[model samples]
Target: MHRRIIAPGALAAASLLLAIPASAASYSPGAPGIGDPYYPYYGNGGYDVSHYDLRLKYQPTTDELRGTATILARTTQDLSSFDLDFLLDVSEVRVNGIRAAFAHSGQHELVVTPRTPLAKGTPLSVVVRYHGVPSAKTAYGFTTWHRTPDGAVAADEPEAAWWWFPSNDHPSDKATYDVSVAVPDGMQAISNGTLQSTSSRLGWTRYNWRQNKPQATYLATLALGRFDITTSTSEGGVPVVNAYSKNLGDNDGAARASVERTGEIVDWLSGYFGPYPFGSAGGYVPDTTTGYALETQTRVYYSPKQFANGSNTSVVVHELAHQWYGDDVSLKGWKDIWLNEGFARYAQWLWSEHEGEGTTQELADYVYASHPADDAFWTVKPGDPGPDNQFDIAVYDRGALAIQALRNEIGDKAFFTILKGWPEKHAYGNASVADFRRYAEQVSGKPLSALFDTWLFHTSKPAAPAARTASLAAASTTVAQPKSWRTIEATNDVHGH
Candidate 1:
């Protein structure tokens, strides 16, 4: 069933106006909850994810992947238990290591309900091993490859995490990960956090990575290939590492430059905003055609395109900022996605400020000039339809402008204080717009309700004539505001226009 039904209130009008019989549309099996679309469930109950050890037996005639995963999660609710949303290419499922029945809800999600009620916090482990050619159309976006120009296609981006593991399937649930990926003997695997160990058995190599800290499901990643490893240290003394293909061009020098610059950006951001909330920070520039980059915990996966010009600071800064906003203090749900992307975008602007590139007003002007004509900037409610819907320019550029407005209202000291205090107060957790608003009000010692309400929830941009005039007046006193004949002739520079 893959159809959406209208409400009862509209049924009468529809029946009266329509002459033809209306066929009942099938309900989408794996659709998310009514209120929270991305993450349907919520609570303090944590999840333990594992059981992804499987051998990949590839067939040249038919592109397919044969694999399995064991997922162990505990919840406080116990009403004969409920189902969790997972994205996978599964052939078989087993609960408590025994074959269990399961059903596919939609194109992306799977629902497996245990036969018996498990106690709250009691470990309930399920192993799902499947064999199929991974698809790029689904929510997980996991792509299985038979062969590529470089070698076997490595799962990359928001899709790769689903290639092997079954998780909460979104950024909401921050869980602990113990992942062991077994790849062909020649291929090396890279994932989040410090490398625990690697052991070669038979013709396969198993690489182990344990992320003890709380991490969102999307940040979890894995890459397989023969990689050339390079190591460095941050100014703040955090270990920086890079994993690029031995087949690609000279990546060590670019990786070193990227690592050094990344560390510098982290340090700069920490000084203004707080410590780097994550344990370590680095990049993994894989030799691939994918143009996008993901800020996956301490390790960011960058495509070869990002390193084409030696070091892409924009990409580096964007991902580095996520270490604080997205990875450290994530949004409570998809509704508040701006909380993650908006903050990161604003952090980029702050970086520009630190570099003495332009003033905040100039940046605001730039964003305002580039603002999309669609009223969707402030009107599109969260939890719309798909993940791509959440990545609109409004959430990134306009969202940053909204934050910049607040920063301008409150001085840099207070604004940065709020930024530092936000993740520090809510470390390893989730937050909403209301939570941020309250914190900003407390830190800035000003009533920011009107400000946030006008920018965030309102449909139109706020009139800033008074505010602009004040800014211009302040700039004239401290710095040069542009000299003009009309302003110079006036006794007082203040002009009413």
Candidate 2:
């Protein structure tokens, strides 16, 4: 990664320009929260992080992970003190390459005050050194920094960034990452981005990976364990990598096949969702864990359930689709998560149709019927599913239902246009539910407010017009059936957490 050197004169000039009416150089503590209704303390304010250079050394024998996170950020306001959401042990802190006063509070807040006040628009670097045993603490369910049978991996979503390293820890604070992990002699360490280099010395091995694109902290991942690793590239020279636990002695063939199919799925999704959004693509299906698969940027992490049944291949496709919707055009707030899970879940439906299983309408009808009209599933609308119910089936299943409903209402041309163009419009940035409604209306050239109201925000289930859904399924471009595809549509069981 290239280091950015900011000149004093340049920053000073910019700071003066930004401070149109400078009165006094007064500074106060940065806000403890970024004002999300669901998780208030998730992200901090006062500075915008641009890059994270995280160097971590893990000892599986002791379960003790040591880390030093150097965060590069631009000051959004003149600050006396700021906070980073870090949860583990901390020994020292530095601001602008020098030691600074620091304090820890609550469960994950690390407050730091520099010797000198920072001016607005000034670029700064804060290096934090810490060491401790890392543990996964899913505020919602099974989330980030999981402890697998052989080793550990990170898969934080929504609000678990403090489990491994500290950061703004929200989708809105997306930043580029340079993560390097060192493990013991026998164990392998994996993370996002293209592998830059590896070195071994004194019973320790290091693997360095760099993700040059901006990524949310929660989508960041690090898996360290016994993995049967493979390396290759796909269409257009995009690197394809796959690593799963070698411990699955008998099921290795199935697991390997699923990983190898990543290239095929990428090609399939690109045909619909535009070109892949990252420099590399792959997955980590660690054996011996009852966890869920996560779309951790380029590489996803799968649960042991994916190996038990051949049906988990579709789970891989869903997570990969998120590389476009969930990871690329991320949510502006937690309420808009339907933008992530809805599209990914619908992608599974599209795959089901393409491969000669149930058409998307059938899948939608089955999922909607599987949940009774009065069941607890439809109680919380996906557009505003409260924090506790955010991951509920309402988000995944009914969210897909809403998307399919819009697809049928708008016809294939406008629907596919929004699917390919929406993400491209807000590429590498945050989007809200309102943004999607307007886009659907504009592209389709129709009033979609009532459709959005009924399907997304209404408490009651929306009517599924069978004729409309069938028309879409019939008109869609589907290929011949692969003998391997299951006749029954794969259950929406293993969700993308």
Candidate 3:
């Protein structure tokens, strides 16, 4: 996620002044920035990407990856020039099968000028060829595209897809993918969707993966290494593909057990969150130095640290829940990340309550009481947490608390509607906090402006859900009683770290 400056004269070099065909004169250069508040230059404009065909080859000995990205998109406006988020060294570029002039400009922006004016709604094809070592970068204190011991991982919370391929990297521009990676013989490669085919030829093995469902670029990932692979089917008939590195050694057993519980957990979550959103449901464990686990679309990339210390079921549930909250229903911008992390943390509480290990009420109360009245975590609002605090504990912990507060205020039935209906309503699309507020009010039949303001937007920590729920229930006596209840417990353990 490094902001790249356009190399000296890279964009305006005389060599790139190719003539534009005169058939269509109504065209202008598309704007480079997508206008996101936190990440103004994250995605490109004037085009909608529909599909990507990526062919990659990896050489462990050289620590290098060479690849080609073929993007299929449609123009949103008449455009003579467009941009893709691309880093690394690229050799050739083509637009609609014709050689085109392109350059690296403005920190990861690959500006391409086609020789003709592309009409609005016309299908366009862009191809780029690149080669480099994909190494993790520390941008704004977050690591992305981290190289692991055995293989490498391409993952980031909001935006890092630019590191791997030329793309419309922002979350709002979702696209399906067909990714095929070739590695040395005897090793394995895993990616987003079902494994369509695997073949070997002349000491190289290629794993072809297809993720047909619309996916945000960040959710697209690739992991390669010697792995113990497992495949199963959920009771609901969704395929499950789980893998773990042999490097885990003694911890592999715990990782395998977690995989076994994955199918059952997906079914359990389906009971509450409606059908599983993706075609596949599972996770993969990588021997990565990185500390965190990420819900990478169909497969959550579990770090070695997760199973080595302990495999907390709540943590698993937290990431699995993100497949719905974050992956299926994406964020309109980085500012609205609570729509992703908050709902995942809330799912941890929901899972704990259903399993009788702990109650969501207790979890919420525990998190609310962890900080002093003036703690920084409590002071920052989940919806508007500045860029530095985007992934802070406040975003996850306090976000869950705010959502639990909403559940308490709206009662069980309507809250369930918000949970089940939110994902389905915005299935495979991006949504914002204002969008969520309008949706909640529509489903719950309650004027929730004050509630949303206090819990999600206000700077100060609000009253506990218990006090808020009691007041709400007393105010509206016609509301039905919550289907379940649990007395708050005194435990100090936070549900999901």
In candidate 2 the C-alpha lDDT for residue 36 amounts to 76
Tell me each candidate's TM-score: 0.76, 0.88, 0.89
lDDT of candidate 1 vs native? 0.58
lDDT of 2 by residue, 287-334 (tens): 645546678889887776676665356877888899999898999988
lDDT value, residue 192 of candidate 1: 79
- The TM-score between candidate 1 and the true structure equals 0.76
**What are the per-model C-alpha RMSD values against the true structure?**
9.9, 7.7, 5.4
What candidate 2 gets wrong by more than 4 Å, as runs, is: 1-25, 136-143, 463-497
RMSD of 1: 9.9
User: How well is each residue in 1-497 modelled by candidate 3, as lDDT tens digits?
Assistant: 22222233433342235355576557766667676777666787889999999999988766688999999999999988888877768999999999887877755678888866788898989999999876632333444677767777777656667767889988899999999999999889899998999999999999999998999898898888888898999888889999988788777787677666888888888878889988998888877765567888998877766666555566677788888898899999888989988888777778777977567776665566556557777778888787766777788877887788888888999999889999999999999999999999999999988877887777775654544562322222233222221211111122222
At residue 495, what lDDT does model 1 achieve?
9
Instruction: Provide the lowest-lDDT 10-residue window in model 1.
Output: 488-497
Tens-place lDDT per residue, model 1, 1-497, is 01122132332232223222122122112222223444333111224333233334433234344666666665544323233444455677776666655665443345554444344565767777766654332442224221433344443323334444555555555777766766667777777777788888888777778777888766776666677777777788877767776755765566456655777788877876688876667777666665566678888866665555465465577778788887888877666767777777666666556666665565556545433334555454322323444665566656776787788789888987887888899898888888888899888999987777656666654454633622422122234332221111121111010
Pitting candidate 2 against candidate 3, the one with the higher TM-score is: 3
The global Cα lDDT (0 to 1) of model 2 is: 0.77
